[model samples]
Target: MNPELLIAFLASTAGAATPLVLAATGELVAERAGVLNLGLEGMMLVGAVMGFSVTLASGNGGLGLLAAMGAGALMALLFAFLVLTLQTNQVATGLALTLFGVGLSAFIGRGLVGQTVAPLRKLAFPVLSDLPFVGPLLFRFDAMVYASLLLTVAVGWMLARTRLGLLVRAVGESPHSAHAIGFHVIALRYGAVMFGGAMAGLAGAYMSMALTPMWVEGMTAGRGWIALALVVFATWKPRGVVLGSYLFGGVTVLQFHGQGFGLAVPSEFLSMLPYLATIAVLVYICRDPKTILLNKPLSLGQSFRAD
Candidate 1:
């Protein structure tokens, strides 16, 4: 491949991975707190529509991003309330949340279909953005991309080094123990879940406002599920999440460019590449049960009652 083309491919891969990085990082935090909220698709969809609609009406991408995070966080709060307060089954409630988000987003976005808004502007550093190949590769992405990288590092540092990370890990590993020790397990989990939702929403907003700059029903196209898979693929580690997200992102970008590269494969098969790679990676990962058993939060997916 030509040097410039290779640079573009790398750049596109980074952009493609940004949403996954954001969503998966958030999900990792929630799961680390032992809350397995699986409604990421719903949250992302709602966020996408909300971001698009808000940006269109207000003509401000910043507000649109904030609205998207709020929307996602609200949806997550609903999930947290049901599972935490009501003691509902986490899996069932999460699935239901996804369904609700999908329908709700479709309804809210009904009028906004086919509408277009200016894509979020990429941040440019003075001399940095103008450098030959390095500039476009490193400095030309929108703000969210940089934010995703920073968020990943922040989450990793917190989980590994901070006292708060220890508490969250303690809650995830043994909520009863954490609660017995005077840590508010329920409250901690709630915060983690809401954070996850906000991140998922931000990812969705990026899809609408920056990635494609338009709204379409089901525009998230199952990236939410992919993000869910990403957590497992990363073995609940932030660094692993970043690596896995970028790998998947590369797959996603490759599928888009497969035909352009003159591969004789059908576009339909090419479209399946990212998902297919996900399944393949998961199956491979699952082959070693110890890898999962050792890394997964012990209290994950279990509802806790303070009684």
Candidate 2:
């Protein structure tokens, strides 16, 4: 590949990594608070359809994006209410949520299967976007790309350095202990879940309105599931999510682009790479009981009721 092509490929990889980065980081936060949300996939699909629907009506991508986030958060809040407040099984409730989102999005987006969207534009710094190879590599990216990277940093900093992050960590480690220390464990988990939902929604909007630039039924595919797996790959660390997401995105993009390089492979085979990679990573990460005991959220995928 030429320098220009290489630069473009890297840029595209970064762009493709954005949504995964956002989604993974958000999941990390929620899991850190001892709330495992498997509804991420469904939440993101709803966000994509709703984001596109709203953007079409109002002609405002930003507002549409905000609406998408809200939509995801609302679903997450519902899950929180069911699992946290009602003491339902987190895994079962989350799976049901995913099913509901998928059906609802399909129904509402049936009419929007073939529609265009004005994607969010990237802002390039003056003189920065014109620099040498670095320009194309870094400066030429959509707004969401920057937002994803920044969010990773912000969430990582919060988890590692801030008071709230410490509290969130404490909650994940032991809700009973946290409550003993007067921390509002359930509320903190709720907040974390909602934030995760918002991020997942933004990721969905990026799919419908940015990556594809059109509304498509089930456009998110299984990206949300991959994001869920990404939390494990990141060891539930916010910072590690950034690196892990890009690795997955790179593999995903490569699967399509590999054909361009004249690799003799079936398209279906390439399509399977994303999910396969996720399974492989999850197995590797969870293979060790000690590692999970040390790093995995102690109360992950568990229901907590304050007594």
Candidate 3:
């Protein structure tokens, strides 16, 4: 590829990775808090539909993004009610939430199939976007890209460096212990889960309103499941999630552009590359948890009961 094409491709890769990075980071935090939400796909779909729908109606992409966040948090709250408050089966409840979000989004998006949204403004740093080729590749991006990067760093620091982070970790590792010490494990989990939901919503919204500039049924195209897989692929680490997302983005983009090189690959085979790559990564990532504690949050997918 030429310099300009390579630069453009790299830039697209970064933008494509942001949504996954943001959503996976949020999920990493929620799992770290000992909550397993399998409904991320559904939540993202709902966010995509609602975000675009609201933006089309209100003409404010920010408000639409906020609304998407609220919608995601609300769905997560429902999941919390089932698993946390009622002490239901976490896996089953999460799947239920996914089902609900899918159906709800399909219904809500019926009339929004062709609607349009005003995209969010791109954020440019002074001189940073004016640098050489690398500047165009890295500097000129929408605000969400920077926010996603900062979010990953902030989450990593929170999980590793702060007292509150300690409490959140405590809640995930051993909620009984956290509760015994007045950490309010239930509350912490809810907050984390809601954050995950909202972020997933924003990720989905980014696709419909920003990337594609319109809504479509199942527009997320399994990005949600990819995010879930990334958590395990990263061993529940924040920084790993970023690398994994970017890696996924690269493979995804390559599948589309790889044909131009005239490799001996079949078009049908190339079409399945993303899903195949996900499976390959998972197999390589967490084959054995004994050697790697990165599989997931220990308390994840469990019922937390307190006296």
**lDDT for each candidate structure:** 0.93, 0.87, 0.86
Residue 76 in candidate 1, Cα distance off native in Å = 0.4
Reference-based TM-score of each model: 0.98, 0.96, 0.95
lDDT of 3 by residue, 30-102 (tens): 9999998999999999998988988898898888899999999999999888899998998888788888888
Clashes of 2: 0
Candidate 2 Cα outliers beyond 4 Å, as residue runs: none
Predicted candidate 2 versus true structure: per-residue lDDT over 27-141, tens digit per residue: 8999999998999999999988889999988999998899899999998999999998899999999899999999999998988877897778878889999999988788877
What is the number of backbone collisions in each predicted candidate, taken in the order shown?
A: 0, 0, 1
- 1 or 3: which has the higher TM-score? 1
Candidates sorted on TM-score, descending:
1, 2, 3
Q: How much is the lDDT of residue 171 in candidate 3?
A: 88
Judged by lDDT against the true structure, how good is candidate 2? 0.87
Best by TM-score: 1
Candidate 3: give its CA RMSD in angstroms.
Answer: 1.6
Candidates arranged by lDDT, highest first: 1, 2, 3
What is the TM-score (0 to 1) of candidate 2? 0.96
